[model samples]
Target: MPKKALIAWGGWPGHTPEQSAKVVRSLLERNGFDVTLGEGTVMFADPKLASFDLIVPVITMSTIEKAELQNLVLAVRQGSGLGGFHGTMCDSFRSETDYQFMTGGQWVAHPGDIIDYTVAVTRPDDPITSGVSDFAYRSEQYYMHVDPGNEVLATTTFTDAHFPGIGGVVMPVVWKRRYGAGKVFYSALGHNADEFAVPEMALIVERGLVWAAR
Candidate 1:
């Protein structure tokens, strides 16, 4: 049987979680995974979620209950894969301490309008990023506060499009972390449906899901 995948999308509608999740869900299905989607706040409530092969959060930013967080974190630590992009996985949970720790980073600011930003792949030899050389997108340049020990897979340089980018900044755009025994893979792209709609971006997201699930 195909591996099970659950995508929980919530937080900000401006970022269009539901729509973006559909795109991601499709990508997973195309790769032969059994996928499902939950809207708004149901992610933290599903008790059986821990049994799934993967968890993909499309959330932007919000506070989550402590018990809910505990369950999710513990599930990942038990070996389930967790993967997603943008504020959903990284910049999310402004007020939640536990949530922030699991993600390995937080989006502190995005100086300019959601314009194109260039993403530079750091560890090109990694399975998720190896074949991908460099790609640029007209989206927000994520200024993140990252965890020091993460296995960084990709990064981006800040240009004049955003300030506080002083002398140029090299920020991790994609990374993986081991929380207990679980594998976490995150991509700082996919701010919208169109972002993941790109063939290359979609492939990246798909590979990330498969990689994390392993």
Candidate 2:
């Protein structure tokens, strides 16, 4: 049987959640996973969320109910993979504790202009970062409060921008973590539709999706 994947998108339109989810779904489908794209919070609701090998949450900042939060955590903990980027995965669900625990990080702030910057691959040996070099983007440079034990795959050393206190900070641009029996992959990229269409960026997301689902 083909593996199943759920692509849940919503929260804020500013990040282009629907467009991003569509791009990601096409990528996953090309890789042989059966993909479903859903709108709004209904995708994250309980009873409809547990039947997939992967859950791709392309949502930005928002609040969700307690039971829905628990459902996602339990599903991922029991072996379903979770993969996303920027506020879609990290900066999302700020008021929810369970959501943060499952995601392995939270977007604390974006000091710079949320514009272009260089993302450097720190672990070239890792499959996700393999053959990938430093790349530039015209999107948000997310500063996250990441989990200590996560295996960092890539980072961006922040340079001076319009923001005064933003420079010289090392931020994880991409990473993977083991949560119980499941895998979690997050990248602080994909803040806009064009970023998702970037060649290397597309590969990074595709690889992260596959690796996390494994």
lDDT of each: 0.81, 0.84
TM-score of each: 0.93, 0.94
Q: Assess candidate 2 and give its TM-score to the true structure.
A: 0.94
How many angstroms is residue 37 displaced in model 1 relative to the true structure, after the best TM-score fit? 1.2
Q: How far is candidate 1 from the true structure (C-alpha RMSD, Å)?
A: 1.6
Writing each residue's lDDT as its tens digit, candidate 1 over 49-110 gives 78888998888777677777888888888888889888877866787767778878888877
Error of 2 at 56 (Å): 0.6
lDDT of 2 by residue, 106-202 (tens): 9987765566778888998999879988888777778788888888988888766655676798888888998888899988888877787687788
Clashing pairs in 1: 59-88, 115-138, 115-139, 116-137, 116-138, 116-139, 117-137
Clashes of each: 7, 0
